[model samples]
Target: MQNQTETYMRRALELAKRGAGHVSPNPMVGCVIVKDGRIIGEGWHEYCGGLHAERNALKNCTEDPAGADLYVTLEPCCHWGRTPPCTDAILEKRIGRVFVGCLDANPLVAGKGAQILRDAGIPVETGICEDECRRLNEVFFHYITNKTPYVVLKYAMTLDGKIAAYTGDSRWVTGEAARRHVHETRAQLSGIMVGVGTVLTDDPLLTCRIEGGRNPYRIICDSHARTPLDCQLIRTAHEIDTVIAVTEWNERAAALKKAGAHLVLCQAKNDKVDLTDLMHQLGAHGLDSILLEGGAELAFAALEAGIVHKVQAYIAPKLIGGAAAKTPLGGTGFAKMADAMPLKNVTVTPLGEDFLIEGVL
Candidate 1:
């Protein structure tokens, strides 16, 4: 029975991923109905303000789901949201048993969903594939629990940790596969951020280019509102959500605002926009997570503020040796090796000629 529960929970997790890029500020939940050791129905949360996974699965069941085992990646919601409570559907279906991947971190539901089923005489088993379920909704969980946005710092560099040549030429630092992967990742997160230097140099559009992929907000860390009015981000600001984090509302800031940019004033740290304040501000705007695609200085400032929760380092196989070459992290680092930040739960994946190393900070 334990093995069967895990099997169904794994399937639920897989289905939940289908909701990526569609659900934000809401968890991507998947549900499966099973009876007599055979699968009967399966569905995932399709979009924000849409029917939940449990309802979709129950509604789509070809046969009667009454007295069947129900497995869901998240605890079926018990409180009213944009849609009706998932617990209502599960109870109405008269499910025999319930298997949950993890209890929702949301205070409105949390453990209440499972308890509601238990109160109704339904046996509910939780914590099946719990870690995977939590990781799947890390952004939502962080935002709901911390009242701030989850931050991921991503950068591409050579094996020697150099992001650019001695002459500051950084074109094609990583292979095409790595770049494509970054674009796909951007689609999942709520926003992508970079420093003014990146805008001034690369003039990147920062929109998700994949067909059918949702575009994330383009956020620039320009303390003085120095983002060029003619840059790609400014040019497309009317089309895509563009935000400029500034320390003051000067003429430059007003000009960018007039040029279709959204401006947020954040406290300055190290004479740059303070990322902690920026995350909280963005969170208030309903952004659950941000992908920090940076120039080294902004990356370093974010890390120093202890706001960067995750890191994705794409390392090219080739070497670019130069003392003057730029590294992925700038600013004055820790005073000693022992003071350096370390990553946990690290993972490495090969991406063509480059490798991706990711971990929680």
Candidate 2:
């Protein structure tokens, strides 16, 4: 049986996920207040520039919390930002003890919040469900510490490692269940990106159709401003946020901007948008995690740029082999086997008629 603190922390993790797609650049945090061996208050950080989980939880307490135990998914923020420091709220509430799932990776609060509580004579216990907490906030950790968004490259391919047939007939490559799973996964990230080739060929809406999942920002890497103005993404740009990264400002730029698509003029190197510069620009947009759902060229570009942190590939059982068939990855792949990218912590699971393979890059 788990201890009360561990159980409370696990519940906090569950609550934290509720803020997904809403809280970006900021980690999802959940808090629970326990009094008399019962949960009296619980809350989560719902959005940016909003009350943090600690303050939200404190606000919901009906009884005095002077001697109550507080369990939080991440360490309480100690520095001031859009809102007051969470540590101050904890002190104001007179929380006696705190159980933290993981230490925040943000330099502003890393180990400092816990120290503040300890100095106030409050008992602070750290590292309860730490791995779960780390995975939950890895995007925020990567963004804050590395100054870049966490990238997950996703694609669907047949058993013979072909993404599309010779005629480029890529529709319905995966089963309905796997497609639904992709939509659900997209709902959790901050944005989805595709190249001009994919936009021209697939014209995907890139919206999350799963229930209770918000649509993420849509990014199109159209170096020459070639994305059709009447495309589904541009047509619906006024409805959801869309970003077009281009190498040169052309006549079509005005139309795209007028269509409510944010234009990012990026310099091209070797006739390709600089992946490093694009990632930095995305960080400026407050995107902590992004899904790479583009064609093989984009996937290879991201992987070669060493920006891909994870890969989620859905493999169907069928084999669509052809000499002109498109593979899942392109570009100059590793010439030597030893130079290939390695994945760790790989997990394979069946999803309907497809198999989902997820691994850390």
Candidate 3:
């Protein structure tokens, strides 16, 4: 039974992966229903504002789901939102047994969803294939439980560990395929954050220029009010909403606001702004996930604070041997190798000229 449960849970994870770019604001969920020790039906959440995993599985089952065993990759959502509460739906279906991979970390649904099922007399088992399940929704879980954004440290560096030429003229490091892949990633996240260094150096618009999907929030971490008002990211309001994080008493706060920027004032630490606090502020504003596009220092801070949950890197097939040229994160690497907390489970795959790495805390 344990092996069967593992197999089914893995399938559910694969289902969740299928809808990666399409589901936002809604965590991708996968579910399976088994009866008499046999798989009966399976389904995954298709998109935002759509039916959840439990409902999708129930609809797929031809038999009466009453007394059947239901297995889900994530905790059944109990809150009332775009769709009905999944816990109630499971009760109505008369599922007698429930196996969950991980608890939903959203403060509103965390333990309450599981409790609701127990109250209805459904036998519940949790933590089966737990690590894999969390890996599937790492971004969502990290934001909800940690009160910080999930950081994906994306960088294109040479095999010798240099991100750009000595002159810092890294106009395009990775192939076109990889660059396009980055755009797809931008479309999936709720927000894409970078430091002022990236804004001043790259002057990136930071919008999704891929074939489909809406643009994500453009966030800039400007500690000393260095980002210029005329930067492409700030000027392109129609393409994406932009947010600037500044020190609590920054004099440029009003100027940034006058330039039509949403400014978040946060406490400073070590003469730099605290990214974790800024992330919490974004969460309060309803941001569920964020992608950290690098300037190095911000990425290092996110990792140092134990806030980065995943990393995606595009390795270009060249070798620029300058030690001063930045690596993935900007400043001195992680304080110590021990300071880097190990992800419970990690999965890596090749995506054209890049590599896709997903991990969980």
Across residues 123-151, which tens digit of lDDT does each residue of candidate 2 receive?
A: 99999999999989878888899887899
Cα lDDT of all candidates, in order? 0.91, 0.90, 0.80
Better of 1 and 2 by lDDT: 1
* lDDT of model 1, residue 249: 86
- Superposed model 1: Cα runs more than 4 Å off: none
Per-residue accuracy of model 3 over 61-126 as CA lDDT, tens digit each: 978888999989999989998998999889998998999999988888987999989988888899
Give the TM-score comparing model 1 with the true structure, all chains together: 0.98
Question: How does candidate 1 score on lDDT?
Answer: 0.91
Q: Say which candidate scores most in lDDT.
A: 1
lDDT leaderboard ranking:
1, 2, 3
Displacement of residue 236 (Cα, Å) in model 3 is 1.0
**TM-score of every prediction relative to native:** 0.98, 0.93, 0.82
| Candidate 3 ranges beyond 4 A from true positions | 18-26, 34-41, 47-49, 79-82, 106-121, 248-255, 304-306, 332-348, 353-361
**lDDT, candidate 1, 1-361, per-residue tens:** 6777888999999999999989887889999999888899999999998999999999889899989999999999998879898888888888899999999889998899999999999999889999999999988889999988899999999989899999989888999999999988999999999999999988899989888888999999999988999999999999999999999989999999999999999998778888888888999999998999888888988888888999999999989899999998998888999988999989999999789999998
Kindly give the stretch of ten consecutive residues in candidate 3 with the minimal lDDT sum.
352-361
Rate residue 286 of model 1 by lDDT: 93
